[model samples]
Target: MMTNSSKSTLSRGITALVFLALVFVPVIGSRAMVQDLFMVLTLLVLALNWNMLAGFAGLVSVGQQAFVGIGAYAMFGGVILWGWDPLPAILLGGVAAMFLSLPIAFFTFRLNGAYFAIGTWVSAEIVRLSVAQWKALGGGTGTSLPKGTTKDMFGVPQIKDLLGVSSSAAADALTYWLALGLAVVTLLAGYVFLRSRMGLGLQAIRDNVEAARSVGVDPLRLKALVFVLSAFGTGLCGALLFIQITRVSPDAAFSVVDWTAFVIFITVIGGIGTLPGPVVGVLVFYILQRVLADYGTVYLIVLGLIGIVIMLFARKGLWGMFTEKTGIELLPLRHKSLQRSER
Candidate 1:
């Protein structure tokens, strides 16, 4: 009874559920394996958020670190200063970052192309300088987080018995699981949003804002929504980063390079505007990082060279090339009605 189009939607729905399940699997299973898993998940979220803004929305914001720092500081403030719980503090940080992006969106949405990028970069620097000067939160020196409690299943000690893992390891693993869950959730949200009407508006706007406007698409609102959404995820990633480090300094909190470099590289290498691009990029990048860990700057230079090569050969990127060659999207976000002829 199901048509091909229905089949594609069903398939996508199933995949989304599976990805989310993968994110939480570590939480119930074991803690020793959580840290690395979480880090990868966080990176995946970061890459995808960046891709959504730059790839789909056509807004290449170079100053996303503004939100990143805000998120980190929010968490740091909650846990360290207000004596709030870590989890709640982390969530608040992400929310605060999203809210903070609204004003930036209003200001920068008027500019187009390279000018927009410049505006964002300048804004980020302003945020950085302001945070740096705030001595109340340790200013540039950074502050540390207090140790928090851990829970286990059936009222057992999570680290000692329920997971059969060491306390520190268990904590690290839980953070990883949280990051993974967020990444999966963020991806699913993007997938669903793109499949809906708003997503069509976004694609339309991206293709040609003037035409989209003629078609009744509000480019400003769409851009603002995507901008805040991107900030939300990036902020979440920053909060997670703070948890992992248990310390926050203006320098590290607003590390522009950390937010920009890997994400741009990942999105570019994986495939801009494609769901699987960030995942592919992260896998390739992690491999390269591991293999080249000993070489320091040389490793970075090599990564740059590889990125250049990929860009030069396939302007569309690795995932784009794969999509072109195979006509299959492993993690397709855009819902297309299947044509019998193509089938």
Candidate 2:
């Protein structure tokens, strides 16, 4: 009979194998493949962060692009104006977004339900408009990193020297590794958080605020902290994403559809309130994008139809559907135990 500990061990073993496969993908796969995976991983990070905010914390923000924009611009400013290194500037970008998220969260949290969602979207637009006025960073037009700055990006020099690849290839490889690291960290951190006391409290609050409050869950503090953390992680993803593109513009950086809408759709369709949901959602989304991108408007219509179908039928997302059918959780977070039968 498979006990809980044995099941956990099996899960961990499978996870280790998957991790190893991802880590070596760049070595064997084409550079284009690496870059594609990088994009997928970044989107996965966004979906995960948004899921945490909306699914776990009950803060259904529709303006997460606020952080993504600011984070990208912050990294741009750090590298262009302050001459900070690229990778380090990405970290600073996350910090800047976190700092900004406090005020945004403070104001938006005053409302509830749809009002809160609109308020967040409005705040993000306000930020996008304000950022458009900065002339030094190319104002409304946008800007690209200096060639010299990009050539020496973080570990690219070493990567180029070691791999005997061109500067661009080496750079792609470095960013691919960073994206992999970020995805791994984000997934692991989320799993750990969901298993913690605070995470349990957050879920209680999400289910019933008044009851959770009565049970000693500090709803206000918990919600605010999660809001800021989600912004921080989203900001980090935005920074890293633009770093790979080597360019930034207010419009592109703060795109609600690209950074917020797609992420929300992916999360909801993947299965909210579950860790593996975003991972599965991103992969499915990426595949659809690859297959249907040539059709443009038709592609979008199909995507919408699929989302509607999944939501109406599956509701729990692909992973959720699987678990409902098989009772298997790859990364189980619930604090429950399986008791052995007494002989």
Candidate 3:
């Protein structure tokens, strides 16, 4: 039997190897593979943020699509109206989403439980309707990036020269690399935060708000911080995603089904509260998508069924189940107690 330390070392080694392999994918992998992995990485990012919100912070927001849409629209506006480059525009998108979350938090925080969820959904709908009135961005119809917009994006030229690939392929490579970097940063940051004192407080609040407050933990503050931080991450992802597509519409950008439902599905099936759960969930999600994508509504039905099964059988998710059986954790969050020896 492997000791805890040995299992931890093994998990770390495997994780490092996988990350290293992903870094070289653009050089050796085909364009199709790059595109598929880009989607996977972005979804992973979304899943991670959602897991942090619902699973850990107890903020069951159904309006995360609000940040995504705001970020995409902001990026498009930066590029089209302000004549900014796509890279900086993406940053602008994240900032816009972060700012939007302030008012959202202010209002939604007043409600509790399912009411809070509905409040978030209503907030997102309001944002979508408001964005649809911006006539310069094709309003309700939406708009596409101007000609040569992406080809001229920062880093595209350098990437094109280095890879000896066409401008489009280079663009794809640049976005893929960005997505990978974002995923790594988000995962590491989340793990660190969750292991911190504040993270413990956050989890305590989730378990029992009144009990946590008795211990001097500030529930409102931590939940608000998580809300803002998750919005920033989701916004960055939305901006990056729309940049690749080179198009934006309020409906496409703010679709709750795409941005929220699927994300929640991934988190639930993979393992809701565990840090490694989203990664596990995304792999399963990707495989299911590949196999069921051609079957129309059957794909969604299958996904729903799988979610139900997981919830019924493995409440903690697949990762949670695996960890329970194996007594191993790739990213363990439990606090270790110091052993005392008699002198």
Per-model lDDT: 0.79, 0.89, 0.93
TM per candidate comes to 0.88, 0.95, 0.97
Cα lDDT tens digits for candidate 1, 160-263: 56567566666676676678778778888888888789999999998888999998999888888899988988998888778787878888877777777777
Candidate 2 structure lDDT: 0.89
Residue by residue across 156-227, what tens digits does model 2's lDDT show? 889888888888888888888888898889998988887899998998998899999998999989999889
Whose lDDT is higher: candidate 1's or candidate 3's? 3
Q: Which ten residues in a row have the lowest lDDT in candidate 2?
A: 334-343
Q: Every model's Cα RMSD, please?
A: 3.8, 2.0, 1.7
lDDT of 3 by residue, 1-343 (tens): 7876788789899999999999999999999999999999988999999999999998899999999999999999999999999999989989999999999999999999899999999999999999999999999999999989999989999999999999999999999999999999999999999999999999888888899999999999999999999999999999999998898999999999999999999999999999999999999989998998889778789889989999888899999888988777887888876885442
Using TM-score as the measure, what is the rank order of every candidate, best first? 3, 2, 1
| CA error at residue 87 for candidate 3, angstroms | 0.9
Q: List pairs with backbone clashes in candidate 3.
A: none
- Candidate 2 vs. true structure, TM-score: 0.95
Error in Å for residue 201 of model 1 = 0.8
Segments in model 1 whose C-alpha atoms lie over 4 Å from true places: 1-33, 147-160, 333-342
> Cα miss at 100, model 2 (Å)?
0.8
